[model samples]
Target: MCGRFALTATLEVLAQMFDVPERPNLAPRWNIAPTQQTCVVTQDPSGRHLASMRWGFEGPNGAPLINARSETAAVKPSFRAALAERRCLVPADSFYEWQHLDEKRKQPWRIGMKGGTPFAFAGLWENATDKAGQPLQRFTILTCAANEYLAPLHERMPVIVAPEDYARWLAPGPAAGDLLRSFPDEPMARYRVSDRVNSVKHDDAGCFERLAATALL
Candidate 1:
């Protein structure tokens, strides 16, 4: 599951990448945890727009819904409605995953495209009220079985929406469901990172610095 990730791209870069007109001043984030606010791209009658929404959804039982499995989301009550109407694209520079090597040893890895290019994850959003009695919009990333490159780290990863499929994903329909599959491993890369990323407080480029071979063990 994609419980933590990062989006350090500039607003201009994201705007161009997602083709949205709004120019919100979004700061770079390196430790985006679940339930925090982040940018998401969605479509409406007006056009595609970039907006901020909380990372997790409030399920019927009031628990945080951070991810929805692509294979079962259509049949899941918490995600079925949003899957049919409120699909979105979650922009990110890279994501973090933890690999357990032993009962007391786990390593955090940074995974991104081979060139560190920005990409979008297939997402779903919903509108609800917050504790402050104000309207709150939230979203959840979709997960699929891991590809070859990520299987060693975890059994699942976020569903990356290709550039060509962005339109179909935001459009209201079931055809876009086909895009929620594992991203190809060839274009992706991963490396072990410092354990500082284990804490949500450390939000900086250092969190992604590649750890030396001797440090990994």
Candidate 2:
């Protein structure tokens, strides 16, 4: 599951890519953890629009659901309506996953498409009320079984929507359900990165630094 990811693209670039007219007020973030405000694009009759939304679902169990298994999300009570009516595009340049090195240890790695291209993850969103009676909009990333190249790092990976299929994914239907499959291993790449990404407090570009160039703490 995508517990942490990065979105470092500029507002202008995201707007053009997603066909959004009004851009949200957001900066380049290199280490985005769950529950934090992150950028999401949703489609309406008026067309696609970019907005900032808090990551994860505010559930009745008092726990935030950050990632949903794409296989079962269509039928899951918490995600069914969102999947059918409130689908969103979670824009990110890359995402972080942990590689199990041994029984007790793991290494952090960064995964992205070749040439480090920007992409969007298939996601679901809904409106909810916060603890203090405040209105809130939240979203959750969709995940599926990992491809051959990513199985070593983790058994699952977020479902990334391609640029060409963005419109179909935003439209609610069985066709959108077909887009939840794993992204091919050919266009994707993974690399060892500094463990600085393990913390929510760090949000700078340094968090994406190659671990081989630096040292992991």
Candidate 3:
């Protein structure tokens, strides 16, 4: 599951890359945890727009829903509605995954495009009312079975939406489901990272630093 990730690009860069209008006040996030507000790209009658939304869906039990399995999302009560009407694109520089080494430890790895270019994760959003009657907007990333490159780290990874399919995905229709497949692993890269990323409190450039090869053993 993609419970943690990073988005260090400036708002200006993101706006240019995603073709959305500039959002000057948007801040760079080195470590994005669940429930934090972040930018997302969506389409409407006017055109594409960049907006901020909380990272997770608030479940009936008050827990955060950060990820939705692509295979079952269309029929899952919590995600079916959003799947059909509120699809979105979640921009990120990279995402973190842990490789289970033993009961006492796990190694973290940073995964991104081969050249470290920015990309978007297929996502879904929803609008709801908080307990106090205030409006709340939130999103969840979709996950599919891992590609060959990522299989060693985990059995699953986030569904990455390609640039060519962005329009079709953001378009309103059931046909967009075809874009939820795993991205090609040949264009992806991964490396061991310092365990500093394991704790949500350590949100900085250090989180992405490569760990010594021996550290993984």
Best by TM-score: 1
Q: For residues 14-131, could you state the per-residue lDDT of candidate 1 as single tens digits?
A: 8889889999879889989988999999999899999999999997788889999999999999999999888999999899999998999999999898778999999999998899
Q: Candidate 2, residues 1-217: lDDT per residue as tens digits?
A: 8999999989888988999998667889999998899989998888888878999997668788999999999889999989888999999999999988899978999889888789999999999877899998999999999989898889999999989999898885653778899998888877898778988999999988887764321
**Where in model 2 is the C-alpha error above 4 Å?**
173-175, 213-217
Model 1 root mean square deviation, Cα atoms: 2.0
Per-candidate TM equals 0.96, 0.95, 0.94
Model 2's alpha-carbon lDDT is 0.89
Structure candidate 1, residue pairs in collision: none
Candidate 1 — which residues are off by over 4 angstroms? Answer: 213-217
The residue-level lDDT of candidate 1 at 139 comes to 99
Off by over 4 Å in 3: 213-217
Q: Give the local distance difference test score of model 1.
A: 0.91
Candidate with the larger TM-score of 1 and 2: 1
Which 10 consecutive positions of candidate 3 have the poorest summed lDDT?
208-217
Tally clashes: model 2. Answer: 0
